[model samples]
Target: MATYSEEDYLMLSGIQHFAFCRRQWALAHIENQWNDNYLTIAGQNLHHKTDDPYISETRGEKFIVRAMPVHSREYGLTGVCDVVEFKKDNNGTQVFGKSGKYVPIPIEYKHGKEKTNHSDELQLLGEAVCLEEMLFCHIDYGYLYYGKTRHRKKIEFTLALRQELNQTVLEMHSYWQRKYTPRVKPSQKCKSCSLRDICLPELLNRESVNEYIERRLSE
Candidate 1:
C-alpha cells in the first residue's frame, strides 16, 4: 500500500463522505466550496464549546478535556478530535503495576440526535485508527456524545468496523488522486449538508437528464 504525507492528503474525516458518497466528498473537500447553513453554524458553535481546555475530577475519576490533533501516516489522514478522556485504571495488581494504568478514550460530540447513518460512526472510527497508531495501543471502543440526547453512546471497535475503516482509507487516497471536482447528487443527507448550495445536486440531476436526452436524439 502506498502511503502519502499528511500534508499531501486531505483529512480522514473525508473518508466518511467517500463511504456515504464519493461525489459528495469530492465536491466539498476537493473543490473547497461550502455553504453555511444554520445547522452547520450551530455545529460550529457547539464544537467551540469543547475547544477549550478543562479538567474535572469527580468520584475518584479524573476527566481531562481538550482538542487533539491527530494524523495517520499509513492512512494519509489528519484532523482534530473534539475531546479525549484520560482516566487512571484502578484495576491493577501491585506487583504487575509499577505505575498506575491510564486509559485513553476518545469522545466525539455531534450537534444532532443519533441518525440512521454511518457517517458519524466512520469518522469516529477513523479517529480511533489514528489514535491507535500514534499511541501504539489497542483502542477497543469509544463514545459518541450527542447534543440532542445529551447522552453518550458506546461504540465498539469491532473487527468489521476496522475492516471498513481500512477500506475507506484506501478509497480516499484513490479519490484524491483523481483530483476532479465532484458534482452534486442530492439525497436525504443533502438536507443537512453544509455544502448543499454549492453542490446543487438537484440541478446537476436535471442537467444530466437533459444531456442524456440530447445524446439519445443525436444517436
Candidate 2:
C-alpha cells in the first residue's frame, strides 16, 4: 500500500466530483474554480444545518456526532463527515470518556435523488474508510441521506466499491500532481454540471467558421 504524508492529502469530498466527471473535478480541485448552481446551493444549505461541529446528542445507546473530521494517511485523503453515530455495542471499540464500546457509522448528506453513477456511494465509502483508519475499527456499512428523497440509503463497503474508490483516488492524485485538467467528454451529466458554462464542452473542439461553412455547403 502506498502512503502519503499529510501535506499530500487531497480532499475526500473530491471523490464525488472525480467520479462524476474528471474534468469537473480538475476544474474545481486543481484550478480552484467553483460556480454555484441550484444543486450546489441546495447542498450547501443542507450541510449548514448538519455541520455544527459542536453539536452532539445522546439518544439512549447511540450518540450522534455532527461534523466529525476524518482522514486516511494510507489513502491520502481528508474530509469532514456530516454525521457519525456512535452506537453502543459489545463488538465496538472503546471511545474516550465513553461508558462502553461503540461503533462509528458515518452518514453523508447530499442533495437530489440517488445518481446512477454511484458518485454518492463512493463518497460515503471514503468517509467509512477514513473512519475505520482513524478509529482502528472495522466498518461494514454507512448511510447516504438524500435531501430531495428524504430518505437514507444504506451502503455496504464491499471489496469492489473499495477497489474502485482506491483507483479513483489514485487517478485524482495523478491529475493533481500534474495540474492537468482533462478535456470535456460530452454526456447527459454535462447538463447538471455546475462547471458547464466554464467547460464549454461543445465549443472546446469547435471548427472554425470557414470549416463549418464548407462542411455545411458540402452537405
Candidate 3:
C-alpha cells in the first residue's frame, strides 16, 4: 500500500460528490468553485450539530464519539466522522484508555431523506476504512442517519463496495494530480445541483456559440 503526504490527501467526504457527478467533483475540488443551495445549507447545519469535537459520552456497553477525525494513508484521504460508536464485543480489539474490547461503528448524518444513490453509503464506508486503519481493526459495517427520516440505515462493507471506493479514490487522486475539471454533461439532475449557476451545464451542452449566448442572455 502507498502512503500519501499530508498535503496530497483528498477529503473523504468528497466520495459523495464524486459519486454524484465527476464534473461536480472536479469543479469544487479542482476549480475551487462552490455555491451553497438550500439543501447544502441545511445539510451543513445538521452536520454542524453532530460535528462538535467535545461531544462524547458513554452509555452502558457503548461509547459514543462525535466529530472523530479520521484519515487513510492507503486511500490518501482525510475527513471527520460525524459519530463513531465503540460497542463492546468479546471478539473486538482493545481501545487505549478504555476498559474492554470494542468494535468501531461509524455513523454519518445526512439532511435529506434516503435516495437511490450510493453516495451516502460510500462516504460512510470511507470513514469505516479510516477507522480500520487508525484502530487496527476490521469494520464489517457502518450506519447512515437521515435527518428527514430520523433513522439510521445499516450498511455492510462488502467486497464490491470496497472495490468501488478504492476505484473512486484512485480517480480522485488522478484528477487532483492533474488539476483537471471534467466537462459538464447537462441533464435533469443539473437543476438540483447547488453549483448549477457556477457550472453552467446548459451552456456547456449548447452546440452553437450563438445559441449558448442567447440562452445565457435570456437567463
TM-score against native, each model = 0.80, 0.91, 0.91
- Candidate 3, residue 91: the lDDT equals 82
Per-residue CA lDDT of model 3 for 1-219, tens digit only, reads 578898999998889999999888887887777899999999999999999989789999999999999999888899999999999998888998998899999999999988788888899999999999999999999999999999989999999999999888999999999987777568777888998877776556544333455677999
lDDT of 2 by residue, 1-219 (tens): 778898889998999999999988988898777889998999999999999999999999999999999999998999999999999999998999998899999999998888888899999999998999988999989999999999999999999999999899889889988988887669888899898776766655775233444677999
- What C-alpha lDDT does candidate 3 achieve relative to the native structure? 0.89
Q: Each candidate's lDDT (Cα)?
A: 0.71, 0.89, 0.89
What does candidate 3 score on TM? 0.91
Q: How well is each residue in 1-219 modelled by candidate 1, as lDDT tens digits? A: 666775675676676667677776777687655567887788788899887656333335545557788888877788887887665665411212335655567888888888676777888988887877776666778888888889899999889988888787777767678776556446787777776665656566455433544676999
Off by over 4 Å in 1: 53-61, 90-99, 182-185, 202-219
Poorest 10 consecutive residues of model 2 by lDDT?
Answer: 204-213
RMSD of 3: 3.9
Off by over 4 Å in 3: 205-219
